[model samples]
Target: MTLSPDEIITVTLWGVPINATLLFTWIVMAVLTGASMLITRNLRPDVPPNRWRTALEVVVQGIQNQIAEIAQGPSRHLLSFVGTLFLFVAGSNLLLVIPGFRPPTSSLSTTTALALSVLVAVPLFGISRRGVGGYLQSYLRPSPVMLPFNIIAEASRGISLAIRLYGNIMSGAVIAAILLSVAPFFFPVVMDLLGLLTGMIQAYIFAILATVYISSATAPQTLSSPQKDAQ
Candidate 1:
């Protein structure tokens, strides 16, 4: 069995090889884009909300609430970034039930890209909220001597996010493959259900961690205010 989607090349054009990872990533993006367009095409105050709109609202509202609770501030700014991350990861994993489908997230390259996006986003959000100088000064908190450690910590966050997601998704795929060979009957259904649950949980955890990291950079005082108030 192939270890990652990157290993499975689906096509080549002008010496450029397109792997399963790239193929499925584009597929996921296309699906999301088409769905959004369809759902919002008739969005009008005068028209009654359809089931699709209602479901979308519930999902968006849940994400907004989670961001507000974690960031302890307005969630509008973070919603788009965080929501996209959650949906992409969740969509990729959930689609694993499809026969012959390989989740792009099972590839380390894809996970690393996602994590790197979060890494870049944290600083952009930070600078946007606190300004470049202020965001830079966060490294010097308590003492200037701690700057090196803070910088290391910042870099490690992306590595950790990438490894955590890649390991979990890849391991799940490995386990399911092993089970399929050992007991072809009954295990497939069980593994599919378990994989669905695992995918959703991983997506939630990833999004929440990204939110926490961005919130710390964007609003450190707001993050700690609850503790200060309690004490």
Candidate 2:
């Protein structure tokens, strides 16, 4: 059985091979973009909201609320970034039910890319909220000696995020494949339903972890009890 989508070459453009990972990633993005455009094409306050619009709003609002709760602050600034991450991951996994479809998340390259995006976004959001100097200074909190450790921690976050997501999704795919081959036919169908649920859970987890990392960077640091007592 095929393990990673990277092994499957779907097309070649200008001598560069495009793997199933890129193919399905593009398909997911295109589908999301087209659906968004179609749903919002006639958006206007004067007109009554259609079912599609209502569903879209509910999803957006749900994400915003989750962000607000996690960050313990306003969520408007995070809606787009967090929402996109959740939707993309969730959408990719949910599509696994389709015959011959491979989830991009099952590939380490794709998960690494997503994790790296979160890595980059954390600092961008941090620097935007706190000046570059302030964000940099966060690494030296409590003592300058901790700077290297803090830097290491920051770097490790991306690696951990990538491995965690890739391992979970890839393992799921592998298990399902094994079960399909050896187990009863109906058993695989049950596993597919469970896989869908697992996919949604993983997407939620990835997004929440991203939000937590970003929120730690962007949220204002408060004075410690000792510092407060000194004042």
Candidate 3:
């Protein structure tokens, strides 16, 4: 049985039920990363690339530009993570279009895991760039009194990010499934096109919001004013 994002498929191995969506997600991410690395390894800086290589390069460069423009300065170091995440999320979401293949991103478990990672990484990256003290100080924006609200808002964002993507994708898939089940022959094509578009936009949103969150968390609150400079 294939795992899809909306449903969690479990496999029994040695009487232990392992989550198939999680396993598939890990595999998809590993494959994407490995393929990118292999492409880099066999690259020739002076030679022309094939269409596949060119396309991959274009995607990578576009993601790099997004990261650079948002994060700015030395913060562009986050390009790799953003690029990898975008690829992983987009690739996983494509499983819906594949015949008999279920998307890993359709499941709440998978999306929530990814969202948690982004939330966790934000603080870690912030602390790494600005000392722990500076990172903490950034949250005390406007005034120290606002710190608790800021922290709560940050926590809610992670939940909202995960639930928003998961809900939309899952609901879309459900609608598509119902339509196909009722009219198997003529319905899926339109749904598939819509799914593709939605999938792409969702991936872009996830990555962009991630960049924005990272920028906000690591922003420096200067001594001159209450204005905090977000990444």
Off by over 4 Å in 2: 224-227
Candidate 1: Cα lDDT at 170: 90
Per-model CA lDDT versus the true structure: 0.93, 0.92, 0.79
CA error at residue 228 for candidate 3, angstroms: 16
Would you give me the overall lDDT of model 1?
Answer: 0.93
TM-score of structure candidate 2: 0.95
Indicate the worst ten consecutive residues by lDDT in candidate 3: 1-10
Highest-scoring model, TM-score: 2
TM-scores for every candidate against the unseen true structure: 0.94, 0.95, 0.87
Winner of 2 and 3 under TM-score: 2
**TM-score for predicted model 1 compared with the true structure:** 0.94
Summarize candidate 2's per-residue lDDT along 1-231 as a digit string, tens digits.
788999999999999999999999998899889999999998998989999999999999888889999999866898899899999999998888887788999999999999999999999999999889889999999899999999999999999999999999988987887887887667667887988999999999999999999999998877679878898
- Among residues 3 or more apart in sequence or in different chains, the pairs in candidate 3 whose N, CA or C atoms overlap within 3 Å are 5-106, 5-107, 6-106
* Two-way lDDT contest, 2 vs 3, winner: 2
Span of ten consecutive residues with least summed lDDT in model 1: 219-228
Stretches > 4 Å off in candidate 1: 220-231
